[model samples]
Target: MPTLLETYIENRFRVQPNHANNNETLHGGTLMKWLDEVGAMSAMRFAGETCVTARVNELDFKRPIGIGDTAVVESYVYDAGRTSVHVALRAWREEPRTGEREETTASSFTFVAVDSEGKPTPVPELEVGGAEGERLRDRALSRDR
Candidate 1:
């Protein structure tokens, strides 16, 4: 069983010349690609099998990550079903010089586990073993609001 912290994965991608848009901010499509990749990895870690995007609940780009900044993405499993896992994901912009970071986007995505044959398979029950875990699960559930 992977703990909440163990399920967490953090990665950073430097925005380069080609990673930007005409306006010099990270492109929406590029960000979505990163989100999908990280979200699937988090779900696969929790499910112990390969996973694919089942759905994207919501994606809110509140701000922009500039071209020269590093895009720091983090993901973790917050909810699960018999074959699906809900991952909470966030991306932040980090200024290399000042070491400042701000969240630029957030999203919740669902992934379904698949077997070696690429068929949907059952996933382990998401374990919320204590108060913190319960709180995270509750937070995930409250996203419906």
Candidate 2:
């Protein structure tokens, strides 16, 4: 079994002109792509198998990230079933120099592990035991409410 913390993944992307809209903020599609990529990585880490996104819950964009800012994406597996891994994802607008960050986007995703034949494959049980693991799981769960 893999612990919940073992499935955590974080990645940062520097918003450039190509990733921004006419208003000079990160484009929604670009952010969504980054979120999906990070979420899939976390699911794969937990499942130990190729995972495909099954569903994406509501994505709420709280603020815009400027072109020169950095988008920090974090993801972790909070819960899992026989074949499905549930991941919580969050993105923050960060100032590289000041190291300041503010939440910009939040969402959850469901991914299913797959075999070579593209059929569903079973995933190992997630160990959310320890205080750190439990705290992480609780925080993710609470965000849904």
Candidate 3:
């Protein structure tokens, strides 16, 4: 059994000129790619197997990460089924120098653990407890519902 905290993942992506759009903000498509990458990694940590993206729920880009800003991405598994894991993901734009942060996007993702033959495989049940685990579980579940 793996705790939710054990599956948590966070990554920072520096917004560069190439990653930005004509408006000088991070491109939405690029951000989605990053989100999927992090989400899959989180699911794999919890599943202990290769995981593939099944679904990415509604994506809402609330704010733009300007060029030179850092995009902080967070992902964690909140619930799991026999072969599927539900992950909660969000991204925030932060000033690299001052560390000021503001949420930019949020969404729920579902991942399915797969075998070498590309077929779905069973995943371990999430064992959640402790203050941190409980808090994340509650937050993810509420957003998921």
Steric collisions counted per model: 0, 0, 0
TM-score-sorted candidate list, best first: 3, 2, 1
Kindly provide the TM-score of model 2 when superposed on the true structure, using C-alpha atoms.
0.97
Q: Against the true structure, what is each candidate's TM-score?
A: 0.92, 0.97, 0.97
**Per-model C-alpha RMSD:** 1.6, 0.9, 0.8
lDDT of 3 at 4: 95
- Which residue window of length 10 is worst by lDDT in model 3? 136-145
Name the regions of candidate 3 deviating beyond 4 angstroms: none
* Per-model lDDT: 0.87, 0.94, 0.94
Identify the runs in model 1 with alpha carbons over 4 angstroms from their true place. 129-135
- lDDT ranking, best first: 2, 3, 1
Local error of candidate 2 at 33, Å?
A: 0.4
Root-mean-square deviation of candidate 3: 0.8
Candidate 2 collision pairs: none
Q: 80 in model 1: Cα distance from truth in Å?
A: 0.7
- lDDT tens digits, residues 6-106, model 3? 99999999999999999999999999999999999999999999999999876889999999999999999999999999999999999999999999998
